[model samples]
Target chain A: MSEIIRLTTPLKDEDIVKLKVGDNVLISGVIYTARDAAHKRMIEALEKGEPLPFDVKGQIIYYVGPSPARPGRSIGAAGPTTSYRMNPYAPKLIALGLKGMIGKGKMSDEVKEYCQKYKAIYFGAVGGAGALLAERIKSAEVIAYEDLGPEAVRKLVVEDFPAIVVYDTHGGDLEEMGKLQYRE
Target chain B: MRVVDVSEITEAVAKLCIDANYNLPEDVYEALKRALDEEKSPVGKSVLKMIIENADLAREGVAPICQDCGLGVVFIEIGQDVHLVGGSLKEAIFEGVRRGYREGYLRKSTCHPFTRANVGDNTPPVIHYDIVPGDKIRIVVAPKGGGSENMSMVTMLKPADGLQGVIETVVKRVDEAGGNPCPPIIVGVGVGGTFERSAFLAKKALLRHVGKPNPDMELAKIEKIMLERINKLGIGPMGWGGTVTALAVHFEMEPVHIASLPVAININCHAARHKEIVI
Candidate 1:
């Protein structure tokens, strides 16, 4: 069994550090969705000193580009995307007070190092378990990059959104540890 | 000789597109159940359990199995004696995809190459067709997700590298892919064809039933060995780690130039969505 913890958006630095690799988290409150395209625009905005679409302080940005919501649905089957594509832009956002990332796949060594240095934690959601994960989201609204279609940045209110800590703030890696445990 | 209307093809393809997105093929579903029953790592078992549950929910058409509904990859085998009437075969397929994505509430994942602009209707699907001897046309719709497709690889090994070389290449691809392609992946290996055919073969191999083996027992043995070696890597379910890194390994081989041994690796996420129709 794994440790179950509840986390809210605009996550606290202290709370992030308390999460060790492999902890199970049920994230609540407001979270933002930003995939590869949105990350690019945010980095460009940062370089130009232009304002970001939303404040990054204490935020957990999920790497997702959700499918179109059907009639009367809050959102379509929303799930974490492969996070490695956003590696180039993650450390900058981490430096700008981003506390957590919810996405699937491994981060780069640079991103891993930055998570430790900047006190951010990277979590992995089930990659293909989108339909199941969508049940936890209560509301969805596009906030940026409307032209990106499914890749648009959306703000979502989630309740008990589940994830596993892949990279802890202290540079621990759950995947490596998990793999080693079963090695024969 | 047989006559078939392209409109019928369009309707069939549209339905297939939606069905493939919502439903996990029987073979894939059974393999996931087996993986859940067999996986040793507790975390791995938990992930597999979630995957099995997800499949049940996705079958209702409430939402696609994955957020990435995937590009519409269609494989067709048309009998030489059949007369096709109505719209262009290519257009019919795309039209089906367009209708499927829009009406089924599936994601439109296709995009223009350079600018990354959304293609809107998920049109201009990736399609392959071959002419066969029968009077019936067969179509298989495989919604290939980006996560796994991006991890696929192709290499030209020196013919002397032999079968061992091919095995090593596939195992390495899965190892490097790790958690990215989504674990308990179904690996499709295309061996010995030319560069292009090898890639196509790899993708085509994915259309095989997950638990089925090549009729060639020698190649089936290779697939078995490859599956065993891959599971030993401890990638497990969703890369959480366990004894079931891959549910199955399907390989298709063809003759190649004497000097070149080309091999391609295509990985399908646990969501391996595809369905077949014969007309």
Candidate 2:
């Protein structure tokens, strides 16, 4: 196991530049949540040259549509949704200055190519570990698209949020590496 | 003949929904534990450990095991001797799903496919009904998540494709899916019947307990061989890579049309949530 790197949200170029694939990270601070529906809306806004519900520059968008909070809790079982569904909208966001994305599953080649070109990073969270992941989120408030139900965009305050670097700007690929290492 | 009220069905379905979401079935949990023990990679073991812990946390009734609570899939075995009264069986099940999702704090995942409109309540559940001999109704609720559901596929092979064709198609489906379906996945293979019936059987097979072999010795042996081939792909846990890519491969095969050999594969993530009730 490698040293677990600590990171704060709204990641800067320097914060992500030195990172490599397979590095473990504990991200703390504010991040935004958006799934398939919200992504489409955001992209439409950008295409129309209108201001987005949130900024893309130096921000991280987590692909998740959390269950409703259990009254006293700030969030419900919040975990990463499949990232591939967001592949189409990701490169557009990355090109517009989104520096990091947190989600599970494989990303497309275009998204990966954009990440390499723009010095961005893609982190894979443990899929299906929702109840456990919600522990890292201190608070959540919908920032836009309330009608989207669980898929609404929310501003999330997190602490020690766990994830692994799956794709790095420096051309390291953990998915491929992991498969090759153990492949029969 | 015995009479059964739709309200009774509704109540049971509602409760089953909540219970299924909050607790991981013993079969699934134990299979995961066994996978953890057998997994060769440190990362795979750690991932499995997190899954186990998440299941424990969800049992506290405070959080769900996964955010994708799934579009509720219900399987009901209705006794032919029972007369259902007070409401339509279909609407009663929908009412149960609506209440269960709203009250249990489960996510409403159904939508207008083309418009992408939220359906408010998780209704129009994928309900499968079977006619049996008794006076009771047996309902099984299995919430199918999008991640694994998206990886499922159906193919119509020539009759000549035979057993080898079935094996190749299923193995290839998992291989193509890789980690996207969530590794250490439970694969359900359906053979024979019509093209659509085969797909249905593949899904129904997912309702079976993980790690249990098919009752038919011939199919059981094939299940074992297919499982070995899938794990050898080294998809590992969550595709992080390792030795335990799949925990189990289950099959439900039936005799089909002489000209058609249809194969359908449905993959379920390790979190496979399901519960059964008799009323």
Candidate 3:
């Protein structure tokens, strides 16, 4: 197995290009959270020339809607949601210099094209491993659309949050690569 | 006739909802362990390991297994000789769901289809009722996640399509879904009956133990064949790609009108959770 890569948020162009599909990554520092509802709102804000909840440049957005945190814990069962639901707005976000996205499932062709062209990367979290994944989140607070409840946009501090580089700037795809390697 | 209080029903439903979401069913937990042992890719094995560990943590912490705690799906088998009292059965079930989501810290995922507004308390569960011969009530709560539910479908094929058509359609559905539904998924297929009944069967089939064959020999054989074909797709664990894309393919068939051959496929993520109780 190849050595795992460690990264911090607000990823640089160098960080993205050095990665390949199937590479294990441990991402620390700050990452933003959003899902279908928040994504739509973010794009609408962009279209109206309104400021976004957070600056898009050099940031990572995790596609997750975590359960309500218990009394003392920072979060609860926080796993990545399926990524395809964000297809409509992903390209727009990528073009705006969003450096990384964390979610499960495949990206659309257009999303992938934007990732390659704009130097962004797509990372896959172990889908459905919510409770275990929640352990890595140091803190979380809703930054925008708090009324959206679980679908609200949150800013999170994560440490060694596990992910796999599913799509990279060089047009690599782990889903296809892994299949080719193991398919009967 | 045996008298059953609606309060008992409500309490049981509430507990089942919380239990199903917080604890992974033993059958599914074991299947993940077996998948971990058998998966070839290093990443796939790791993914499986994490899923197994997540279940353990959720149970120990008394937290939700997945944030998408799912719209509460209640399957009730009511005995013909039992008398229900104290309240409306449907209302009781909804109350149970509301209390469970609030008390259990489960996500309230139900919403207005077009408005996208959440129902807030996860009320008005998707309930299915069956009348049975005994004088008892059997309640099963299966929280249905949106990700996997989105990947499910129902189709009406001509009689000429037969078994081959069903298998091909199911395989194609999973292939197209890829990792969207979450790999190492349990595929529940409901064939024959009318369109809606087939869809109902598809969802109901998921309540079966993971990978256990249908009692009917013919369907069991078909399930084995379809499972073999699906895993060959190499969707692997969480679609990271490997040999264990699906842990099981469960097929349930019923008689249908000669003119219709309806089939529905309901995919459940590896969390494949459902808990039951009897009263």
Q: For each candidate, report its DockQ versus the true two-chain complex.
A: 0.79, 0.84, 0.80
lDDT of 1 at B45: 89
Q: What does candidate 2's lDDT look like per residue over B97-190, in tens digits?
A: 9999999999999999998999999988999999999898999999999999999999999989889998998988898888788778999999
Candidate 2 docking class: high
TM-score of chain B of each: 0.98, 0.98, 0.98
| Weakest 10 consecutive residues of candidate 1 chain B by summed lDDT | B54-63
Considering only N, C-alpha and C atoms within 3 Å, which residue pairs clash in candidate 3?
none
Per-residue C-alpha lDDT of model 3 across residues B1-279, encoded as one tens digit per residue: 999989898899999988999989999999999999999888899999899999999999635889899989999999999999999999999989998888888888888888788879987799999999989999999999989999999999888999999999999999999888988999999986789999998998999999899999989999999999999998899888899999999999999999989999999999888999999
**Candidate 2 lDDT, tens digit per residue, A42-84?**
9999889989998889999999999999999999999899899
Please state the error at residue B104 of candidate 3 in Å.
Answer: 0.5
User: DockQ rank, highest first?
Assistant: 2, 3, 1
Q: Point out the higher-scoring one by lDDT: 1 or 3.
A: 3
* Lowest lDDT 10-residue stretch of candidate 3 chain B: B60-69
State residue B90's C-alpha deviation in candidate 1, in Å.
1.4
After superposition, the stretches of candidate 2 with alpha carbons farther than 4 Å from their true spots are none
For all candidates in order, the CA lDDT equals: 0.90, 0.91, 0.92
